[model samples]
Target: MQPSHPGMTPYPGQPFYGWYPPGGYGLDPSDALVTPPGAGLGGWFARCVGAARRGWRPLLPILVLTQALPAAVLSVLVLAVDPSARWDAQLASDSAALPANFWSDLATLLVVVLGGSLLLGVVQAVGWAAGTWVIARQAVGESAGLGAALRYGARRALGLWGWTLLITLIVTFGFCLCFLPGVYAAFALALAGPVYLFERHDPLSRSHRMLRDRLGLLLGRVALVGAAVIGFSLAASVLESLAILPFGTTPLDSPGTAVGAVLTIAVVAVLTLPAYLAQLVGLVVTYAEQRAHEGPVNAAQLAAELG
Candidate 1:
């Protein structure tokens, strides 16, 4: 008989199995079997880190292709449709005779920009859903590859997009009412993705149900994740500015330079996709913990059900 793998844990209701090698067990040992901490914010953070470390292979590519790729494409499009370039050309041209199709050009640019924004939003929502799915699988000690995760995410893409739109509208409305309400609403709805993915329920209603009595803990944890994201993002922005210092000032004025800038930003986005994944993993783990708190549920069981 094969010896028990130190990394494998057969938690209650969940059995641990060793990975097989080529012509062996039919599983890859390199795919770490991670069991998320039972409860608490510390455990949540730890599980997020563990999940990222073990599942980066499956998670990173999905995030880059689904999230960063669309952002990069949109960035390029924005540069191509730059209003400043058109304005500069207009000013440089003969003022008495406006360029033909100037209005049509402007209309086309507007349409492209609007359409690209919508497309990017959809891509991000889908990416988040997929990333969450992967994290959920990893949290419960199950393994999933990029293709499987993407297919799963695509299946629920429409629901994820709808949920994202609903949450955005609600948060926007909350902000209009009051700043605090808006902040509260954002945190309150933060787990909608996990709820939608795992519970297979309407995002808003299920999210509200999850946050019912656990609002305080959930809010605190969400705030911690938000702060980390903001802090890291700010640091990345600073580093990015420094990195582009050698490119000279006003690098985006010319088309060639602007393309370079977009590529640089896209590269940075690709590198940082894991950070976004960590946040999602934390949220997924938290959702499972919350469910466990409500009843006799565990991460492995959730993973099996989600699987």
Candidate 2:
């Protein structure tokens, strides 16, 4: 066996000479202990799962508060403001005597709903940025606390948000053109977050370039991770509904029922956090795998470079 590179650290019980160059070994030992020696779809999934297991402690809270909390809060607010029953009551009663501010009330509700949606987007952006930092640290066998992750994410929040908006617009435009083009565009730009956070490069163009010839592998890995997230999310939604069933039959009608519904949603948010973490881990692994294919580099090396 050849000697390991000067800066490389061999895993315990693994000889220094056993260390292979970036793409040569398939997966980096420092990044993934269980993944096989190649950066294939299965290897990527294994690495992601391994990373999630190892870094769940720090990853969970950040994901819950940043990604899930805002969403759950907004959902509860929307449910509370639902105007269907109220509108129906007004219609049945004297239509001419409808409340003076009925239209104004509706306008106010619309503004609040839109504002809540915007806030949720901002929170998710921060979460994604910070989560990326945490994953980068974990990939190199390092640990970062929630505070450090949040701080790092705050610094990058604006950039990440802008990137997200740009990508959304582009994808939306592609969809406007045709469904197939939109799907193609979405898959092609999937690496924008990782590329933006880690490489500090133009994520849109860089992600497209990195995925130029590896579309099939990227899509397969994404589909696997996406399916898992969807499954977990559906399960969480079902559980949330069941949990809130005891609150009351008319959850939207009373203060007590509303409070119970909100709490249930919050709990559900925390429960489904793992799904978000899994998706993040998969993306990080996918980014590292793509980098390996592009050149002779491993996760540790990428992490070091980002640092």
Candidate 3:
């Protein structure tokens, strides 16, 4: 027997969620723990936190492989090719003009960073898709596992990566124009990933509309998420810097110290786990809230769309 509700019928076997808002699209508040039924900021926060709690199990392994491990490897490569090794020795000898290998080292550093970032873009694409899939599914109480998410990631990686690249270019172009523009671009596109994952059409226009229509709400929410991730990364970076200090500026000078520094970088990478979780959960939850505001949407619809 289904419980009677005006204007909307609960899903079969689905427990009745609380009252629907006058303007809500039939999604009961109880359909999702991670997505409130068009709830306000407080609801968004609650769902964000709840999604994180439910999805962390899968999110962790996905982030560890696609984000943290790659980050550690990239750091090791950067450190290994660092021109600072020569600069450190030169400074110690009181030579101040320029290290002989400065340009060469700097060039190597640029190449390493550029190349690594390009490749990292690919893996990060996988992470974003997989993470979103897991979170959205979990929000709707669907069964989602690490293997399934990874597989989903592979399937969506290409199209999502292209969008990711487009968004990156948009931000880059904004930066090229000015700092303020860049920040604006970032906040506007902050929800682009989740939008693309769920909507799968005209993401750029859709995301921009969401931002334009609800500027303050979206901006504030994204800012909080951005702040959290940046703060965590900054803390991890500071820790890495402090940890490698014992090895001095030229941490790669000795095999023993080099290994230690590498280990420190790896640990720092692992420390970024929460940042990944925050970014995924916060953005997805925020997007869901935005959709709820726009029309009738719930965790199950989102989960189905994510597929």
In terms of lDDT, which candidate is strongest?
3
> Which residue pairs collide, candidate 3?
none
Off by over 4 Å in 3: 1-24, 33-38, 88-103
Q: How much is the lDDT of residue 220 in candidate 2?
A: 81
* Runs of candidate 1 exceeding 4 Å displacement: 1-39, 85-110, 237-259
Over the stretch 138-191, how does candidate 1's per-residue lDDT look in tens digits?
755667888888888788788888888889899999999999898878888988
Model 1 worst lDDT run, 10 consecutive residues: 24-33
TM-score of each: 0.75, 0.80, 0.87
Candidate 2 — which residues are off by over 4 angstroms? Answer: 1-30, 33-39, 91-106, 176-178, 238-253
Clashing pairs in 2: 26-37, 26-38
**What Cα-based lDDT does every candidate model obtain?**
0.67, 0.73, 0.80
Each model's backbone clash number:
1, 2, 0
Task: Extract clashing residue pairs from model 1.
Answer: 20-25
